[model samples]
Target: MKNYLIALLAVVTFGLASCGGGDDKAADNQEATQAVEQKADEAQQQTQEADNQANDNANQEENQEAANDQAAAGGKDGKTLFMENGCVACHKETEKSVGPSLKEITAKYGEDKAKLIEFMKGNAEAIVDPAQFATMKPNLEITKKMNDADLGALADYIMSIK
Candidate 1:
């Protein structure tokens, strides 16, 4: 009976020691997994931040290019030039006649003032009314030398006529 009790105690001690190591291994594995997850999360966050910054830079560049184009076209205040250049003779603010109106011009060109100047330069066609432009061939000869800045200003004015 005494030997049996001693053997049982020895086995219990051995089992306890073996169980302790299993808990240590489990804790180590859990810690390793948590660290890997943390590193992955950090990497994902950094990538997301970089993507956002890149997107911001692209947007800013696009806006600057647009501003440069508008500046080249005399920007938003070109109306005074349009009135001085006799453009109003063939065109009205909101109505059409021998020529289409300023409202129609804005609808055709939106705020792209450079395109308006290019059309005046004869580098482009009048998209709004190709037929009406045939009536302006005589005027085009006169307008060819009117200068880009002046023409862009006139276009800007037309865009803002409303």
Candidate 2:
């Protein structure tokens, strides 16, 4: 009877230990699963951010391309061309700097846009400031290379300054 009781006690103790160990293993597995899930979430968030950034960059590039295409199609106005070609450095709408003012040029041309275009093309002589022809020679060279449409736009802009 004593041996039987001892054996029963040993069996119960082993069973209890096994149950405790199983609980500990279950807890460890739960912690491991949570860690894996958290890492996956972080990776997903990073991927989403990267995708958004790529989309933003693509949008910016598309906008820039559209603007370039518009410019190529002669969408640039005369004022934009004037400023781009450095005309504003020497001339102003009402004030004269190194060159005659737009108002003076317009007054001299007097609704004659063709004559102004000719002068810009270096075909006609300078009538507004003949003595300043030497200073205008370089600018005339630049204008001489412009297309007729651009020259017409520039002339129109000058004529409208009054």
Candidate 3:
């Protein structure tokens, strides 16, 4: 009977020790899981911040483009006006296209700013490429409405190009 009691006590002690050890292991696992969740949360926050920064950069670019377009409309520079007025579509800086290149126009009319502005205003006839006058005449509708300053700037910009 004494031996039986000793055996039962040994079994109970061993079982209690194992249960305590299991509790420690479960606590360790819980801590590890919490750490993993924290890291994942941080990574998600960083990703969200990066996305917001990218969106802000895009908005800044859009705002800058809008400002540039506005400047091209009434700004002192003629290059902007020329670019915004669709002059680049038909005329290139150096190469000839549907219309005479800006260089060619500059070479022919650079000596006379008044004449160039008058031509842009549609008050003067085509002198460089009269064969394409019909094509150029239609484009003048936009040019004729420009103020004198913009025309002068455009003429100056065309002449300034090499």
Tens-digit lDDT track for model 3 on 1-162?
Answer: 999999999999999999999999999999999999999999999999999999878965764564465477756567778888888899998899988888899888857979999999999989999988988888899999988777877876777654
Q: Relative to the unseen true structure, what is the C-alpha lDDT of residue 98 in candidate 2, on a scale of 0 to 100?
A: 93
Instruction: Encode model 1's per-residue lDDT on 63-117: one tens digit a residue.
Output: 5565467677655334444566666688889999779888988898887878877
Give the per-residue lDDT of model 2 (tens digit) for 19-98. 99999999999999999999999999999999999987896576456446557895765677789999999899998889
Which candidate should be chosen as best, given TM-score against the real structure? 2
In model 1, the Cα lDDT at residue 105 comes to 84
The TM-score ranking, best first, is 2, 3, 1
For each candidate, give its TM-score against the true structure.
0.49, 0.55, 0.53
Clash-forming residue pairs, model 2 = none
Error of 3 at 161 (Å): 1.9
Error of 2 at 112 (Å): 0.2
lDDT of 1: 0.75
Candidate order, lDDT descending: 2, 3, 1
Off by over 4 Å in 2: 1-73
**Which residue ranges in model 1 land beyond 4 Å of their true spot?**
1-80
